[model samples]
Target: MSLTAAADPMLPEPFGILRKRRELSDTFTLELEPLGGHRKFAFRPGQFNMLYVFGVGEIPISISGDPDDDGPLVHTIRAVGTVSDALRTMEPGGAVGVRGPFGSAWPVESAEGRDVVLVTGGVGLAPMRPVIYHVLTNRQRYGKVVILYGARTPEDVLFRKQLEQWRSRFDLFVDVSVDRATGRWRGRVGVVTKLIERAGFDPHDAVAFVCGPEVMMRFSVQALNERGVADERIYLSMERNMKCAVGFCGHCQFGGQFVCKDGPVFRFDAIRDIFSVWEV
Candidate 1:
């Protein structure tokens, strides 16, 4: 009944590729600056863009660069599908069609003055990157900032250098864990949930933002609950089969809502009931 797509939100504009770096064996981080006479892409913390590769098709990739940048719009994508693989093979000076900085975002401003807890699993850290930068840049506004990250293996970790830099800051606390570890791995080996036991924060004054596999979020919420965080203060980013970035296609529908428009970011209390429903 309700439509969220704009009259021509389907149109994709050309963006010039500025840089591309291989992040993992199958993943890449692309830096794109809008080329159609526009200098910047206005975006918030959790928004995403519909990246189109000429004839291959399009996919929704979350914005991974700082929202403060004007020229380069960065997106880190995994080469797991046809469209994405094509995008990955593109070189600098290549072209990509971009549609949006759509969907809701993490409540970064509301987090001001409160102790913030950021929990991420695997590539989930990409979407949470902007929020982390915001907190660090405005370090004086918030209280304690804690980051707990988990990956499939030590080699699977994203933003390794940035994580270390953040860890070096005396005011920020970062803990990383891997599900599988090799002989050379010296970090904690387990799920992200394990880090919660050692997490330092006032459960009553803390707000947490979690993103990852839905199963990971499920378990994270349980752990946060045991730590005394209320459902309303816990947030999550949901993934659905988004076809039309504007929500015309029903591929991204969850329950009675469209993840494209309603959210990719939502409070845990708003979607907890539907989270366990496979059909949602």
Candidate 2:
């Protein structure tokens, strides 16, 4: 509950949209700078913030910017509801409020010296983007880096340019797949889990991070397990109903754990008991 930097967790600090880029038809990325001469916002990778759009409402969004970068705070948001829609349409120079950086973080430092495999789908990649940046910036810290991504279609891919750039890097392994193909599309056509079988990594010594729909995550976990990755070495980012990022509200409760406070990122084995429970 006391994980945020705000003096009062309930109050939000002012921030202005420095720039906005549309990633997809319904999703957009916002680059926000502190307003009123405030200090730069810092947050660990995988942590999220409560974004407040005045006269509308607030919603929790994961931090997508690089943790080591001293620049605007970035959030890739999908316009699913009223608040998020407002945020997506707001132009540059528009004002918004920020309240968090709540929840757990990916074990980037611990993965050093071991292979790192990232499995994500659709917008889920936003939460994992920070981790990718961290690994690439400190390339020598880890043994191998592999990224497996999936989308509904070729056009649904997020960060297309960045993914291409990462794919070109000799030190990193990037593979993309889609459920269906479209015009001029020529790449793997299947779920992301298929790539795990051919991916070159020491499954016994590698750590996997997965973020996506619950069904996709469940399947990805199974695939990783079949590949010999231990349950303890696998992590999942859980995005549930998150109101009141400080945990005052019980919206994000998953069994006995509060995802807003205890997680958002949790080791697979830690929640294995309830991960498959219906409506959990």
Candidate 3:
């Protein structure tokens, strides 16, 4: 569905750019404040926004800040291409366009009172970060909160400080892994699935939200199913070449679904049969 013009005003206000150029490993965080105000933008834990850099183009990015905080909006952007590279060059007080609070969000309410496992790889943490924050802030509402994250290497792990804090709070459990470890690394030295195997959560009472590369999500769902989580209970975020965040461009089309509007987040059962086909 296209975002309505009426909805435009409610979109997260374009506040002045906060920290326009801070590097987090190879990626960067472009902090922004609402225009003329310091009031926080209202966004659900797993929603995303389309950020437009003047003359550089736009891309769909997950909102990574706490849903409870009404402060400036923060986005964790990886430097992968031209648009992202340009975003990295933006200085504080520069102007950038934004639209949304878009797409589906993790079912935080439905996961209440149940164990929630978040499996993420690489920048996949961006989308899952809010869910993690929600569960931590309202710890009493959920059962066990487990986070399993894997990166290419030690340098690729995102939100190191936040992950450290989450490690200390609530009934939090975190296992970080890397495909290959450097000399300084002291964590698991394999795929994230290996860590999941070690955590040994009871799948019967748990729900999982997984986001990462398609291959990683596929393997993660397989691992969860092997551990007894039902296909219907496992959720995944599917990535595609999304152009129009409103789902008009058809670039992110997968079979009959639009990854931008219909998903980005989807239940396994809804797309299980289609996933193996590779074309979608």
Candidate 4:
């Protein structure tokens, strides 16, 4: 199907501000309900929404709650710029516009019955959070679930409660590391690539999804390939300067693909060549 044909009907609605606003560290999680109706925003894991803040601006943020949370839609956003800073100031029960459950979702269905490894860094974890939730909630449908996460330091880690819960689950495996130690912190301290060396997996039977800074994705891909994972079995989420979520804007184009339309998620082999071209 054509990309524009995939537009979601739930996109253009004025969602109600259900919980006003709450802080999750330096980021804000806005809980919203349908403004004038009872219909819920339906979406798959890994899909993002274009959240509009009136005069401020709109930004693409991943749907951070469970896909089946029919109650309200949740968006976790960090205050990084003017628009985001404005969003941070929105009171609970205020108004905000949303346009999507846009772009492609992760290949969760294809991952059934296979060993799935999820590797993430920093805020990159936001996009992949739903995928992890999908896998954990439907644990019997997959094989071993391993999550390797890294961040700048302990203070920068997102979803600490969720991460701790994953670590405690006997059915799943969670490993975390940081680039530098902060004296009081006691855990794996090194580059995210360092933890990969000890990530036990039979690459031949595994499907890996990685997201983070471009440099980190490159190194993660190299590590996965070295361990014998097929390029097609490794996936990466791309982050670009996107304007229109629709394909008309060329802001997020990479080679022949539009990151907004074709993917924020792509198979390793599909973008392997362009990834190294410096500029695409």
Q: Residue 173 CA error for candidate 1 (Å)?
A: 0.6
Q: Assess each prediction's global lDDT (C-alpha) against the native.
A: 0.91, 0.93, 0.82, 0.84
Runs off by more than 4 Å, candidate 3: 1-14, 20-23
Q: Write the per-residue lDDT of candidate 1 for residues 113-185, one digit (tens) a residue.
A: 9999999998899999999878878899999999999999988999998999999999999999999997699
Ranking by lDDT: 2, 1, 4, 3
Weakest 10 consecutive residues of candidate 4 by summed lDDT: 1-10
Q: Give the TM-score of each candidate.
A: 0.96, 0.97, 0.93, 0.92
> In TM-score terms, which candidate is top?
2
| lDDT score of residue 272 within candidate 4 | 89
lDDT of 4 by residue, 86-161 (tens): 8888887788888887888889999999999998998888888889878877899998888999988888878888
Provide the global lDDT of candidate 2 against the true structure: 0.93
Report the poorest 10 consecutive residues by lDDT, candidate 2: 1-10
Residue range 103-179, candidate 2, lDDT tens digits: 99999999999999999999999999999999999999998899999999999999999999999999999999999
- Report how far residue 135 has shifted in candidate 4, in Å: 0.8
Query: Candidate 1: where are CA atoms >4 Å away?
Result: 1-7
